[model samples]
Target chain A: MEKLLDIKNLHAKVGDKEILKGLNLSVNPGEVHVIMGPNGAGKSTLANVIFSHPEYQKTKGSIVFKGQDITNKKTNEIAKLGIFMSFQQPEEIAGISVFNFIKTAKNKLSGAPVDFFELKDEIAENMNALSMQENMQNRDLNVGFSGGEKKKNEILQMLELKPTLAILDETDSGLDVDAIKTVSNGINMFLNSDRALIIITHSTKILEKLDNYFVHVLVDGKIVHTGDKSLADEIDKHGYSTFKGK
Target chain B: MAKTQLEELNRNIYDFKNPDDYSFKAKGGLSREIVEDISRRKNEPKWMLDIRLKALETYNKLSLPTWGPDLSELNMDEISTYVQPKTEMKDKWEDVPSEIKNTFDKLGIPEAEKQYLAGVGAQYDSEVVYHSIKADLLKKGVIYTDMESAVREYPDLVREYFTKCVPLFEHKFIALHYAVWSGGSFVYVPSGVELDQPLQSYFRLNSPESGQFEHTLIIVDKGAKLHFIEGCSAPKYNKVNLHAGCVELFVKEGAYLRYSTIENWSKNMLNLNTKKAIIEKNGKVDWVSGSFGSKISMLYPMSILKGENAKTEYTGISFAGANQNLDTGFKVVHAAKNTSSVVNSRSISKNGGIATYRALVKILPEATNSKCSVSCDGLMLDSLSKSDTIPVNDVQTSDAEFSHEAKVGKISEKAIFYLMSRGLSEDDAKAMIVRGFASPVSKELPLEYAVEMNRLINLELEGAIG
Candidate 1:
């Protein structure tokens, strides 16, 4: 498998308090990596730091993506380099339609003109797959949407952008059974030989639908254990108490 | 992040000037002679001339406002109250002078009239050069023409509602407007007649160191409905200019009238304009305003709900960029039983610009069961900008309900980062947030005007990244 992302000794902080302390990980193409950690394990912070979120200051070390040093890049630049993140709690931007936002993002990242008709058809198809109403495209992005609907919208964006790497941060936290199935199916469709995923979750319910994955147990901002799918089952049954204080 | 340049963001698209091309120009100053000369040149009646003289007296007697934005920069002695373009009011577009017509053409007035307007009026400097209404509307007894002609033709009707909504003695700028007001529109929607399309008026002030004081008076009779749109723009100049126009609207019983305005004055302008509406029993008035230009602006469109069950709604937005101070809001007075009013206002300030929203909502003692709700939100793009919300709510009646909400803050970094993570540049992200912030007022405008408002916001946010 081709190496897609490499993180070495990454130490990050938010407002003088270090959250990600010398964390290191690697992601390969065509692989689904599940990151399971207890509370205050810096799960969301790691996702944000990878995207160079302004709030997360990288105090030390480096993050290399697709053989490029993107540690100091702006979020938009990193995004244009084929990186997408599904936020745990997305911000509701009023008066901007979901369809328009996705279209603009796709156009900006690709640096190409998009056919309006084709884009509409593709959006409608993806929305239908997610069981989202047609009017959802015209409504303000994430404004007044239910928790499940917001999560589905995030997956919809991920599918539309077709990024090389995606970081899903707690995407299944607030979803119901049907919504989880729909979201998992959408994620599965996005899985191919050239793409990679980093799934951050507390529960293994969504992982049951995904395959060919590696599970890493992260405790206190560092990955303590790494194994195959059985590791996820182990953590599901025994919890992260074994990884604590390691 | 690279700091955005304030100069690049404050660029003006309407900054071309036509050489001093006027058939008549009054000497720069405000005096009895200048006001009398304007009235005499228009060949007004004795009563109209007397009113102008009285207005001049009032203008001299009243002092400048003490509470709002400063007006120490306004020098009446340096501003020419009137500058008559060469062309007279022509009902046909082809007859208008090319130079003056091109100005309106660049502003998309002719094209807009052909596509969406039932009537169009174009004012240049101190006089309305072009005015026309659709034949169907004319056949239905709807009157839409220049105010000068309205005074000549329908004196009784003009005198009945003129300044009744916004009296001449209300303020110093209003008094000045009444004294030197030269060009504007006079619209009358007959009883039971409803216009399918809006009638638009475009005002262009081309001369430097001059003022554009146009008066707009509209009346919607019983069971009638009408939507009127007003647009203003001026070229930039080194010297200061003034725009103290006045608008008065009267909606009769069971009538509806919507008044929309987009004011884009130059940076050298001191715009102190006034607008008011009087709604009768079961009548409704809606005000949609977007203020985007001018060095200093003090505008508060008022609504007087005087009849039972009357209604008024105001939706407005203001964008104050570098070197601009805009104090804008709305006022409503519930005088009769069961009257109601709703106000939603938004403001954005950047690059040391100051935007203040000052509102007043009053429920009188006899206004039983009256309700009023006011919401004002302000957004500052950077630390250098300033925004304030000052609201006064007085509920004299025990049975009335009044609610007010005000908020002021800078752009959220988390929101910007989220947008940036979606592949939008930092500038684009900030622009989108500001556009969304002002969308409530823009959505209330016509489709084309809403697009123009968004474009204006983008231009104002060109380099507004923090």
Candidate 2:
């Protein structure tokens, strides 16, 4: 399998403390990779490093996206180059309608004018696909949206941007089982032959609809183990205690 | 000198007296002769000069403003009342001298005029250097010109509501403004005329230790609608630069007007500005303002709902960084039955800066069935910064509904942790949170303007020291 996103010996820290130490991961196109780790295992830090979050310092390693060394690119710039991260806690932008917010993000990605009818159709299709009501599109972006609703809105954004590689950082953390299923379905629909996904999670609930290509276990800021889909199930059953106190 | 000194805010409009070599400035303080000289410099009509002198006398007789932000530090005697950038206003950019035109270039006036604005009138110092509008707007019976031209062409109409809504004697600053007012915008939208785009005026003060008093008067006739935006900025200078401009708006029956302003003045500014609107039956007035920089500011945009079903909405936000005391808010008066008002104010104070939200929502006896709601929220970035909410509600009617709620808080640690846990950098998390807190004000703007607001919020969050 060809690598779409490659992280080689990545070391990143936030405010004087290292979180991702020598973490290595490679994801291929059309692959749905799950990273299961204990608390403080640098699971999300890897995602931010890949997406180029401003806070994470790349002290020791490199991240190559599509053969380009984009280790320190801005989040918006990385997003423009076909990488999207569904924030764990999506920001609530009041006074900016959902329609306009998504429209802006989409415009930035496409670098062109958005056709009103096509834009409306695409927004409606994604909202309906995620079971979001029509009224949610007109309200301020995540202003009054519930937890599950915000997660759904994030997926709606993911579906609209149609990025080549998506790093869903706990997209289902605060969701109920039913909502998790709906959000998983939204992610599942985007798993095309040209698309790849990296979902950071310790729980296996969001895996109901996603078919796994690989599962990596991160312990103490390093990917200590790599295995098949059953690794997630094993971790969920035995708990992160298996990798703890190492 | 007819300037009120409000000293509670540890502020003044002056510090550095001589930063550069310049001329054309008047002595500080206000008097009848001062007003006459100002009118004489502009070559005003006899009638207009009379009004200026009258306003000056009224200013002398009126006491200092006792309400709202303090002005004790605004020394009228020390302020150079007027600094002329251009000898006369010009319609073409090139015809304007290079120095004055260069100032506008530095301020990005021509670029903004081309990209976003339908028309633009730029005031360099105390005088307008350039004024021009798209020919189409003029053909549509929309009048957009400088106040000086309006006096010569439409004196009767201009005088009818010039000081009718906001009289000169209302406050000391206003009286001084009327007396020393130089170049400002005069907009008249005819009935049923809807301007497809926005008209804007950009004021840039380049003179050090000088004052810029420009009057902006807008009248939207019945069933008409317009959106006028104002952008003002002065570069960092050591001296005091005063901005005591006044804006009076008349929204006629069934008409609507949305006024937007972004004040990015330097910390040397003692912004003693005033704005008010009178909305008639079935009319609406919307005020969208953002104050980003000032040393000390006392500004309150008021809306008086004088007819049944008239409404007003004020969405504003202020940001005060280190060594600044910014006092800004809005007021609404429900005068007639069924009139309504909604005011939402937010402020962010950091680096020991003081951010205040002061507002008055009044319901008169005749304003039955009227509803007024005011919500103020403040965000303090650190322990040193301070935020205050002072709201006054005077309800004289029994059938009115008014509610006021305020919340002042520090940045949420839980929110930061959640965002960081989701792979957002801590800085990104905080920036996003601050933008979210100011989202109400940003969202009220158009697309480009909203993006500008976000950029401002991001910039202010960079040096946010704990």
Give one digit per residue, the lDDT tens place, for model 1 in B373-448.
Answer: 9999999999999999988888898999988999999998888999999899999888878878888988899988
Error of 2 at B97 (Å): 1.1
TM-score of chain A of each: 0.98, 0.96
Index of the highest-TM-score prediction: 1
- Chain A TM-score of candidate 1 vs. true chain A: 0.98
- Alpha-carbon DockQ of candidate 1: 0.56
Q: Cα deviation in Å at residue B453, candidate 2?
A: 3.7
- Going through the candidates in the order shown, the clash numbers are 0, 8
Off by over 4 Å in 1: B1-12
The superposed Cα distance between candidate 1 and the true structure at residue B131, in angstroms, equals 0.8
